[model samples]
Target: MPLAALLERVSLTFRRQSVPAHSGVVTFDLGPATGYPLKLHLSTWQSDEPFRWESEADSVTIASGAFLEPPGIAWELLLATEGEALLQGMPVSVRKVIASAPFLGVELAQVCGQLQAARDLASTSPLLLILLVDRASATGMPQADFAEWLTQKQAVLCAAVDLPASKATAKLLSRCTLRPMIRRELLELKRCLNTPQGTALLRHHAPLCLEHFIFLSHYEGTYWPGLLPVVDGILENQRSQPGQSVWLHRQLADIEGMLGDDRQALRRVMSLEAFQRLHDRLLDHFNDQINQVGRAKLASELRVQYGGYPPAPIPGHEDILPITSWEALLQEGQRMGHCVGSYHKSVAAGRVAIYHLRAPEAVTIAISPQADGWVLREAKARFNEMPTGDAMRRIGQWMDQLTDT
Candidate 1:
């Protein structure tokens, strides 16, 4: 269905009604008549005080704000549903004003002016009309255009919207450069935009590198958030010097291997040369293990010393065992044709923990500490192959147990 028709069916209504003396509130209602029932209530008193906002649906408060705060529940809900185009079409200037002046106080004039600017732009971009009406009605602001509205809003767009020119931005000259992005993608983009390297890449117009960066950023298997700059730097170098033997295509998997179970270790790595040195050392160590009997004896001794450090056995998986020693790592790596054996130092330092599943399939699992809890870094069968469906299901059940505990 057309976005306009969808919105009409949603039956969005906004009211700026007087409450008691010395106070006012803006209420937005999406009723069951439209199939999307939501109630947003905002209360404001004096100009110096912050406004409060809350969202309710089905007779329950889905979200609420503390004193003087404007909860993002309204915007988030809009973006999650059919109102995305309206929000995405809004100029950044208008968005900033709405966020800063939720109560329509000191910035009321500025807010109205931006809304008028939105009105002026709506002729050329019809979606802006929907956005303009939404904001203007919600805040009870006038929509007639002022002479300076268009020029001022244009200046804000040019200054703040420095994202690289792409097909997405090419058409949205007056709207947010990130207009095509959804909420989660916007969050990821914000993370990169805060960093100098990421900003540089975006502003410098490196589409190829940006494409690779986006791909790696969205990959859930690898902890790629903090390592975005590393990927950007490598891609930049590759672009500048194509003759270099950089593993451009396989960089993600290779970096994951180098990371082992301690993905955060990338932060301490000061330079590409330092990363190369660690990679070389791991390669050398993996190549040196040749004697199986010697490996077994060393595994026994190390297990005797560090066995208690491993996490308790996975409850129902009697065939699974935690790998607690360098010899065990080597054996797993040799059998799996992977570089996990080099993770002994990380395991010994308690930075990473490895688990081996011995039944249904010989799979090696690596879990590492993330922000608050453990995360599965990677799970692979022999020869660096992906585990079978049943094996993965079992691994997932074990991970769920870990979370429960």
Candidate 2:
């Protein structure tokens, strides 16, 4: 049968099972009526605890392998029936978030024009701007954009709800520590739509909601509800204190570190020298054990430059100094790119500046500080290939011969 035909068959079956319409409209279980077979998931999509009380419907239901609402349009899901063809129901969409840092300036731009036209600016409605970021990468482009906007015009920070490992965001507000009023709203999103988190929630009845406080919960999986609430609360508190972007940036750093994606954490800071220090430490971490052909050559080059093998960390110096792990180097290098600086002494030796590839994802290339230094590196004299400067030198030599004639 065609996919549409199969879905229609399922939809008709679901509508038939739905509670009948009332006088004008029947009192119905809207949850089942909206979609035939949506599996509820933890709001954050990654929680492993008991789900919120709201996920406990009369029974978990699935049709054609999907845990969905009855009478609602069917959706394609990556669901597998665990056993008995249809899967059992579980706990679902429950979450919370609190702004962790002072965030009053977040939405200033959106409200700026509105505030300008108002008779009493202070009396005008206070709108909140909530920002969320995926900690998967070191470059916090989303968070940084939000911070820049806030810096341009300060605004109130609304509730920052962390999404659980579940794939929920707007719905996770119920889990926010700062506001209980948003619970119904967050839950309603789950009930209305069979989100992936909702599917996970219904299939696996675990804690769908959680407080978004950094360092509050242990190092769990990537479900993010914990950090948002702290950010939300911080924003709420910062409303009274204008101009606190620096503090806000600092807080982001703290949360990024807590999640073990410290590369992102460090990028949130404005300092330039941190990466240089990071470079030194990363070299020490692997203790010169560069095994691969590519990495081994890079290591050999470093040995020639630094002049010795790196010693492993001692007990006394270990805690006092930052851990120079490869992970850290990769994270920082990915964010900043390798630190390129002048090799003044090396330039005098006919070499260009030293190009340090701090992250594993980079290649080191030497650039002489002198203008002609690049030509020498690109010349066939250095390599067998017809390098860029080789043709240029031939053209120049021809010009000289013509002038001599």
> Each prediction's TM-score against the native?
0.46, 0.17
Off by over 4 Å in 1: 1-180, 201-205, 208-285, 288-316, 370-372
The number of clashing residue pairs in each candidate reads 2, 80
The per-residue C-alpha lDDT of model 1 at residue 34 equals: 42
**Residue-wise C-alpha lDDT for candidate 1, range 1-405, written one tens digit per residue:** 332344455444443323443344445565543455666655432222223455667777777653222343344343334332224334554454344323332133233333455434543432222333334445544333322323544324322334333433322323322233232443344344334454443443433332333443444334333344455566456654431222332334455565567766555554455555555555445546435356777666656766633543333358678875566677777777667775655676666788898878989887878877777767778755668888988888888987899
Residue 333 in model 2: lDDT:
26
Q: Of the candidates shown, which would achieve the greatest TM-score relative to the real structure?
A: 1
Residue 222 lDDT in model 1? 42
lDDT of 2 at 270: 30
lDDT tens string, model 2, 177-273? 3333232343343232234433333333223332222222322223332233333444556432432333333234323333343454344323223
What global local distance difference test value does model 2 have? 0.28
